[model samples]
Target: MEINRRDFITKMSAIAALSVLPSSFVAAMGNEKVEKAKPKYPTLKCDVVVVGAGPGGVPAAIAAARQGAKVILLEEDNMPGGAPVDMYVPFICGGPRVGVFQEMIQVLNAKHTIGGRTCETFGKTGSDGKNHWWMPGSYAEVIYQLLEKEENITLMCAAPVVGVKVKTSGNRNQVTGVRIMRNGDYQDIDAAVTIDATGNGLIADMAGCEYMFGSEAKSDYNEPVGIEVADGKVQPCTWMLISERIKRNAILPIDKLKGSSAVEDNLNRWVKADDKEDMIRRDAGIYLHWGRTVYCKDTRDPLLLAQAQQEALERLQENLEIWHEAGYAVHLAPKLGVREVRRIKGEYVLTANDLIAGTMHDDVIAHAHYSFDVWGMKIPEEMKHIGPYGIPYRSILPTKTEGLLTAGRIISATRIAHSSLRVQPICSNIGMAAGTAAAMSALNQTGLRSIDIKQLQDRLASMGLFDGLKKK
Candidate 1:
């Protein structure tokens, strides 16, 4: 006779106790079946849960903690630093790097700078006009120190969020927390508010939230620039590396490299350099190089990404030999620099027009200043350096989702707008806003969308988040 699942389990449990009985009695029940053990998931509760402790998530967690919220910062990697540590993208691109991002950079400039001149004025926004990059491990060191200082933050590294815990109510999904893979079993961390700072919108995507992937046609968002038709293309993946001179006085073979630009440290800004030799001579101990770039068949797929990385490595063989012959050792990044992924659709989808016009929204929480630097897409030189634009609060709130917020480059924006704000500093600022907002939602027992916008703005402003843009 067939037994129900519960009854079967109960009977199997009773049979398990039969091991203490006589062998004859146990043997008589040989036809009894035993069920395989199922994995048990442990549950945890917190005020705020921030996933992906990179530039964005770190600040988000810190901001929430500072607001008196018990924050749990989850990172899939063993350490906290995001792209800079994992992907070796230690280069700083866009500007107005204020708030928690500014704090980290200040520490980086003071203690971790490899080639740049010593920063006399800490926390100043590009006043020195010096560009700097630290060793990849330096970022991790600084991030760890910053996170450790926050009393309310519980950081969990190597905790990958495999699933999202949500409560569904008619078309809307309210995110409660996340399920992370831990010790071969699932552990759920339930929080009042969840922030998706995964940079790829992984949490939001897992929560059944609608998201946009790939390039959208110019007509889709009515942006000023973009292709006429949606090409389903994205920015190419770059494999970055740091090269150091193993032998004393060995020159970097910049001229021999093809398709890769050898970026020497802060002698002169590499962005607009007229004399490469002069810049190299000023400071040349270490150099950051864009090793190789390749277009993945599908960036969202792990197999395709691996294949693309293999292709990039194949292309970089000649350069690797060149560097080795020059007595330089190259440290390849642990992961490929993926530029784009899922963009969760929010209440306001930022577009190129918002950036071009520098629209200052009433609910502006963060300010981003960067040019349209979409890889593989050619933009007019004149339109490249647009003025600072505002990132509204609505842009971080995923559509129809409660108790959840989007942070980093994955926040709501068209592809054109994303290309600019996707940089580290801007992403950090956005994360700070998301974290602060999340804390408010958790403590006040209010929905993410129902929080007072003015209060959020005031809190952000007090934190120096609004210092980047001069309000009109």
Candidate 2:
């Protein structure tokens, strides 16, 4: 009761220090110190683990499951459909949309066509050249139906892969599986083959695999088309949205909008005099609009992405007012449409030359046929629409990494080459190839590189994946 001021201060500091300590240690203040235990995460085993249930991951999961591998498909979002469901990018851009992708598109065309056009050609290339897109929710429905049919696939939604379980030795990494966040704790999902289909190459990057981000100079890769000097700049992010005609008989204000494009359900640009009457007669109320595009300071950073989205929304206010006056309501996407991210380094980095020359690699796993559609850069007119080119099996196999494969737009490719193959169809095909290879590797108990390329090619060929290459 007669404590001095100095003693009181000293005693308070000691109590503060003890308060920050663990309860067990604090309880043993004058006794033997207790050691803190390391956190133990629940571990789940599977034959193959596919992260990100977007265009690439979904197909990868389905393909692997079809090949008799137990697949655990994880999606960060609550639903499975990737860009289409999440980003409102429901339009199909690239071609050679065969294999599991073709199947999905066929289902979308038959059941989910919003343009009031009957699709006569089922599983036909390009759906008989009829450009079409579905409502974003339709894509989710179709994906759920397709995924449900697969008995060997376990679809886990709202599960994000936060880390990779990698074994490293002398600059070489063997990805055993991935760790996901679960119930405020970490849960490990071990697999024989792990597919980095996160679209950002997050898992591969975490696994200590080398990755290329942003633009590389033309001289660096000897690419046919790219900037002379490397800029490390990625394509601008777009905020995609859909506008619906709310009021009856209200004409779409396409001419007044400066940045947005009003398209028909068939994805055909709405021409003023050419098809206005026909469009109104069809009662096509919904139109996909490219809301606003802005370059993010650093796309890899979530905060930067959010800032870019805010900037886009600010820029979109004028368009939003215009649409409201035109009796239309807009539905913005859940996330910004990111065009590029980490392109994980692989055995072979595909270049624009390969796309232009239509190089059919000996181990071609997928054929991508799309125009060079660089958002910020202007490609030559002739170089715009190149012939069908092959995506080799080597391109999906990350260099110096075993049991890990890259899928979607994250596969190794120069910026110019990525502009061509980064679309949904091409990505889906790549996912199919990656999934099949993953299944093969898991079932055979062999390394990814040691798998039979010839057999893989034959399997893809049988699925009509090579049909596009044959047409050329």
Candidate 3:
């Protein structure tokens, strides 16, 4: 029970499994021999079986289930809140249109859910100048309840999808069902259609979908602003932290540090700005946990990345000392937030050009409005001041795989393109889009590649996707 820094490090090693889960989860598996009787699955078949209940996966499963299709959502983690609950992603930003998203937020909102009353928007997040709003209770319960309340959906936890059962009809190979490793036993679940909202495209790759890894070249996508990405170098992925400010915290606001706290910290920085470089209250919603940390990482060297994470933690701890010096106590969180991972390839790759052009697709299912915000050890001078962008349907469908789709930050887009598209709102929308596509394909008895785009678009519009658009 005694825990010191050494214990913390050891515990972190155990917890690193969260980002990738155990290699045991990734261990190739098939029908394993068992002695006694096997447990029955949720059902022999479902309209859609979405793998991984992350940002996009949850929404996709919900959409399909709502669309009158039987759904089964699988997650390796026990509870289904995804990043919000598992990690201290305490402050969620980068969402727009907010009707459904806001309803979800309101449920998680401290006002309605926890008795903390406020609907205030905080100013620019970090030096990035991105607007963020606050809510309470983490919203994990609210999201899970919504899915559970839906009669058409089934939820499965601690089930790692090993692969899929595929069948080829003509030149197209479609995913018929999935193979999963549940509690050390390998089994199969047959479904009419399947979704690869697994984030890494575990389903898409297994189903033999064409894919790409890392940032795309500017020439490849023809995005005028595309960067020439280098090998062994990514913008870096941050495992973020969220900590709440303790009672009587004295962390200085950027404004107060600048000697300006007469105004509300959140309002002054986020809304009323005398100039673009205006400051907000630094302590607003400050979690006593990991404070002012970045996930910039080197994927090539695990040790190097681990060191970066540690350094970030140290710096954050130093800030906690700052809180203590200011006469407050700091409570650090248990886990870190993830920023980047492997994105799955889709049929039509969304490019940076599509984003800059403010492109809309006839089959546009989701939209994102975030900056070309790349993270790393440092922010390059060239990369700054970018804003929100778009995501297209092509980015969700795999190139050579049918009955499969990807959502969230792992969609098939160039890194720069994904940089903008991977917002929380967009991830939720794509989840809905991919789930609906799988459900519609199953219900209509068509290949995922051949689902009616017009119908899909109309349904999405009905669900409040891409609203306020002149043309959808």
- Estimated TM-score for each candidate: 0.88, 0.87, 0.73
Clashes of 3: 16
Which model scores highest in TM-score?
1
Q: Cα RMSD (Å) between model 3 and the true structure?
A: 9.9
Per lDDT, the best of the predicted structures is 1
For residues 37-60, could you state the per-residue lDDT of candidate 2 as single tens digits? 221666789999999999999999
lDDT per residue as tens, model 3, 281-380: 3335442122344544433234765676686666555455554555544444334445555566666777766766667777677766655665543334
Clashing pairs in 2: none
If ranked by lDDT, best first, what sequence of candidates would result? 1, 2, 3
Worst 10 residues of 1 by lDDT: 22-31
Estimate the TM-score for candidate 3. Answer: 0.73
Candidate no. 2 TM-score? 0.87
The local distance difference test score of each candidate is 0.80, 0.79, 0.58
RMSD of each: 9.7, 10.5, 9.9
Question: Residue 139 in candidate 3 has what lDDT?
Answer: 60
